[model samples]
Target: MLKIVVGGQINKKEIFDYIQNYYGTENVKLEIKNDLDAVMAMQSGQFDYYIGACNTGGGGALAMAIALLGVTKCKTISMPGKILPDEEIKKAVDDGIVAFGFTASHVEQVLPVLLDAIDHKN
Candidate 1:
């Protein structure tokens, strides 16, 4: 089963709900944490992916993730009004983006695409 850690500075529950709705509890192990805990979990190999949100996409939500996980391992897939294409999202997965960050408003649109990419990878 895939293990994912969902967190952020804001709207974390919404994102976590979307992920649960998409993947279902049986299919993946999900954990809801604060940004710092999420990063720590990822570093400890406790999660397969880290999904987070912030007002800006790359600021508070992902700054710590990137710093700990490395720039190449993290990707900001969406903003308030800008969501990346499915291909781009897939490309990020292909490029080894284990950590994803986006604006809260885009979770509905971004989660499915990101989850799909992760599903295909396995």
Candidate 2:
């Protein structure tokens, strides 16, 4: 099973619920953590992927991840008025992005694509 950690300034519960519902408990294990602990877990190899949501997607959702995991391993797939294309998200998965961030409002739209890509990737 894939292990995913939820860490963001907002929508932690919603994102966790969405992933659990769509991916199912059988397919993935999830945990909600504060940004620092989450990033540390990720860096220490305790989790496979990270999902976070914020207003801008980048600033709050990914700042800790980017700072700890490095920018190359992290990505902001959506922002306030912008969401990356499905192919791009898939490409990010293929290119090895282990952490993803998006605006809280884009959770429904982004999770399907992101989780699908992650499912296929594993």
Candidate 3:
């Protein structure tokens, strides 16, 4: 099972719904948290991934995550209308990015690609 924590200065409920719809509850355990709680959870090793969003792709949404997990463990997948290529996402996951951040407006494009990369990372 994959454990995920969604947080930040964006719409966490929408992100949560997308994950639930895509992976289903049987395959994943998810929680909606504030940025602080999300960071704390990651520090405690309570989640496999932390997905966060903000107005910009790499702003407040990821500040704490990057701080706690280090910049090497995080990646910004999308920014406003820009979503990275599938191969780029896969490479990030393969390189061990445990935290993903994106713009709120790009969630629809970001989530599916990000999830697919994670699912196929093995």
**TM-score, per-candidate, Cα-based:** 0.94, 0.98, 0.95
**Which lDDT values do the candidates have, in the order given?**
0.88, 0.94, 0.89
Sliding window of 10 residues with minimal summed lDDT for model 3: 77-86
Q: Which candidate is the best by TM-score?
A: 2
Model 3: what TM-score? Answer: 0.95
How well is each residue in 1-122 modelled by candidate 1, as lDDT tens digits? 99999877888888888888888889999989988899999999999999888998888778989888899999999876788898999999988899898988887788888899999997
Q: Which candidate has the highest lDDT of all?
A: 2
| Model 1, global lDDT | 0.88
Across 1-122, the per-residue lDDT of candidate 3 in tens digits comes to 89999987878899999999999889998999998899899889899899988999888779998988899999998887688898899899989999999999988787888999889874
lDDT string for model 2 (6-96, tens) is 9999989999999999987887889999999999999999999999999999999999999999999999999998999999999999999
The runs of at least 3 residues in candidate 1 whose Cα sits more than 4 Å from the true structure, single-residue gaps closed, are none
Question: Which of the two candidates, 1 or 3, achieves a greater lDDT against the reference?
Answer: 3
